[model samples]
Target: MRKQLTVITALVISFASVHAQDATIEKIREQGLTQSKVMEYAFRLTDANDSRLTNSPGYFRAANWAKNELTKLGLVNAALEPWGDFGKGWDLKKSYIAMTTPYYRPLIGFPKTWTKGTGGLKNAEIIVIKAADSAALEAYKGKLKGKIIMLHRTDTLKPTYKPDAERWSDEDLSKMAAAKMDTSRRRGGPSRNVVGSMPITTRIRKLAEAEGAIAQLS
Candidate 1:
């Protein structure tokens, strides 16, 4: 009789717990159905503000907007805290590049971050620099000034054989999740003999800047 009473008590407790959970879920569902602001929040985050590059004006605008919105919703002490000095912010207003002489054809390219703009619509000569090593950079010392330079040779475009987009299979995801840390790469860091002390591109850019090259097409 005692065992039967204990079983009955357990069932009663279980039923009460389940009923409480159901009530909580129903309240949440009702709130979502009637008071959902999903689209509003999405538009405000994306289309309402400019792109949010770190430490940029657009980033701050979105952040402040978010803070204000949260405060309106009764969040306590909603504020943005200062993160220490991040370098100056930059934004692209407009970019245009084309070949006019050979035949007026628009070239597809964007300026690199922190690169100085070519003021107004100006036509400049393009020079291709093919420096194999630091020693090879000496030949173009005085010639690069007032010119747009291509750091590397033009690549030949090839036809694509495979689909441009692909979705990962369950097996691929499982393998990725199971992947272990590559300790061998981390053990010795990087070898100096295999790689140069300073990158070739950096050296090239420094030289170009020092010599007053108008722009770089990379």
Candidate 2:
């Protein structure tokens, strides 16, 4: 009788294990393991299928389409809200520049994003300047009024045709990656602000204007 009881206990344990496995699978399915189906449609609607450009008809169409679609998707009170005017927009049709000094090198540069448009026909001698603030700009203030100023520090690109890792082994790469970086680089610290800060930059720009410095090349 004891042996029979042991056999019955073993059968009960085996059935419990089988029941647990089945429950786990049911839970996974109920949790919507394939709910990634929503993401497929979502990406198509919000990104891939939408054609938009700020202030353009395509942009407007996408905006309204999104609002209407959300409303249809059981969004209780979907509405297209009017916000502040974001001003006008323009696209760069074409632009070109070349260096005529130091060497006849065709220097390559692109303006910053979201900057005021130059109407594809504006051309002037580029004046480079780097001022930390208003005062530093004063040194050449009067001069920069009509000049094409480069406000940032100019960097000459060196020819590094090969990848840096090509010159080092795996151990060297690890050592370089693990090396401590410090602030004493470039031979100067905060004192390197030759032009000064923003307010100082404005002051310097005003001074430059007074001194007849054409638009500065920062």
Candidate 3:
């Protein structure tokens, strides 16, 4: 009789716990449906706090707002914690580029992060640098001054064949769900050669700066 009573008590307690969980979940659902601030939060995070680069002014604004918002929402220990020392934050105030030689047409371009700006409006000539090797760059060393440089070749636009949006097929879904881990790659093979070797892009930028070039366009 004692064993049976203990079993019954355990089952009653389990059912009561499940019922409480369901009631709490239903309350949450009702609150979300009635007082949803999803759109408001999204607007504040994205539209209001635009240009959220790390450690930038916009980033701090968003972070402070988020911390306070969480606190308002009854979350405990809502605060900003520093990760470590980081470089100076950069933000773009204004950007403008245009073609003037052949015809009057505004060019679509944005300043790269950590790139030095041209200070003000510049009407410098654009030069395409097609150096095959670092040795070939010597020829244009003195000539790049006051000129905008393009290090790489211009890209050719390709037409897209796939639709913008589509539902996944049965085969695609099956492949995604049944995917297994790829164990072919070894843990830590010999790392690629990076020491004392500068990338071609970095080399180009360094050369351009050393030669007093106005700016480099990708």
TM-score for each of the candidates: 0.74, 0.42, 0.82
Q: Per-residue lDDT for 1-218 in model 1, tens only? A: 99999999999999999999999999999889998898898788777888788777778888989999999999999999988998888778999989998789999998877677778876889888888687988788888888888876556889999999999999999999999987674556568744664576777888888888888887
* Best-performing candidate as measured by lDDT: 3
Q: List candidate 3 stretches off by more than 4 Å.
A: 28-36, 169-171, 183-198
lDDT, candidate 3, 128-179, per-residue tens: 9887567877778788889999865556889999999999999999999999
Each prediction's whole-model lDDT (CA): 0.85, 0.63, 0.86
In the order shown, the candidates' Cα RMSDs to the true structure are: 4.1, 9.3, 3.4
Clash count for each candidate, listed in order shown: 0, 41, 0
Note the residue pairs that clash in candidate 1: none
Between candidates 1 and 2, the lDDT winner: 1
Q: Name the regions of candidate 1 deviating beyond 4 angstroms.
A: 1-11, 22-40, 167-198
- lDDT by residue (1-218, candidate 2, tens digit) is 99999999999999999999999988889767755456765664558645465765556666777788788878977776768798874444455566666557665665443445455544456666666654555565455655665566556888878866656789999999999978685754566455355556566556556544434434
Question: Local error of candidate 2 at 57, Å?
Answer: 6.1
Model 1, global lDDT:
0.85
